[model samples]
Target: MKKILLIALIGYGGWQFYQKQSVAQPVTEPTVQVLPDYTVPLQKAREAASLLQFRCDGRQHCSQMKSYDEAVFFLRNCPDTKMDGDNDGIPCERQFNKG
Candidate 1:
């Protein structure tokens, strides 16, 4: 009887292990992008071009950004941009992904 119980327990454990392994899991990873610094557009002929810079000091400009691209632009070029709350290279989580 003891031998039969042990065999049953081992079989049950193996079945549980197989069930765990058979379960499919979804893998998700946020795509990281390398963006370039942009310049403010000039409105005149031979106009002097200036680098796009903003002081993300007050009110946190990340939330005000229209899109993730703008957040990437400010975060890349501006020295004061603070869109990346976790400093994970990606920025504007709340605005971009509703994080």
Candidate 2:
């Protein structure tokens, strides 16, 4: 009788442990990616500004304009400006200086 009771108690404990472990674990959901509010063309324009060596000039004028538009504006309005540090005709190439 004692042996049978011990076996039954051990079996019940094992079943409780298994049930607890199964209930504790949860299923996770997948994450989603989000896009920015700016248009693709506007983002391209910003890249052009960096190439053109268009700086903030402490006035924040170019901050509002997209990169490409800023480059075009600088090139057209300030042709004599020495943006092309290497004098390579390409205003804002790698050799150009921001300061």
Candidate 3:
């Protein structure tokens, strides 16, 4: 009886080991998708800013204006451009130095 129990335990352990070894690992690869280089038109940026009551100081209104692409993201994603610059929950009016 003791020998039978020991053999059964060994067999179970071996089966568990084999099962773990046989399991396949998931393969991960970076996705490749063609995306057009997007930029916000100057007119569109000005229009959005104007709609939000944003005042351009000197040459530009918001220092957050790094590029047209960034501006486009802001215009599209930011609900409150006048109040949110970073788009990280903090309002733009509160984040910008002038604001």
Candidate 4:
């Protein structure tokens, strides 16, 4: 009887020790980084600012224009401007076109 009681006590103590050892510990999470968005190009902003220098004028033909940018602005905004000879979107292809 004493032997049986001793074996049972040893088994209970071992089970308690195992239960304490098997308990889980708390875990930590990793950090994350966020980035900003750039929707518009820098060149387009500069183009918009440069476009403010010109307005719709009655002047026609590429000869009256000082620069390629001025000729384009005249073609787009003003009427009766004989700049684009080929009827293409580009104005002053012979005068302003580099390529």
Provide C-alpha RMSD values for all models, in order: 19.0, 12.0, 12.6, 13.4
Candidate 2 runs further than 4 Å off? 27-99
**Tens digit of per-residue lDDT, candidate 4, span 2-88:** 999999999999999999999997787877867788677898987786689988768898888888888888888888899887877
lDDT of each: 0.69, 0.57, 0.60, 0.84
Give each model a TM-score: 0.37, 0.27, 0.29, 0.52
What value of lDDT does candidate 1 attain over all alpha carbons?
A: 0.69
State the displacement of the C-alpha of residue 13, model 4, in Å, after optimal TM-score superposition: 93
Which residue runs does candidate 4 get wrong by more than 4 Å?
1-40
Better of 2 and 4 by TM-score: 4
Would you list the rank order by lDDT, best first?
A: 4, 1, 3, 2
Model 2, CA-based lDDT? 0.57
Model 4: how far residue 47 lies from native, Å: 2.2
Candidate 2: give the clashing pairs. 45-68, 46-67, 49-67
Q: Higher-TM-score candidate among 1 and 2? A: 1
What is the TM-score ranking, best to worst?
4, 1, 3, 2
Which of 1 and 4 is ahead in lDDT?
4
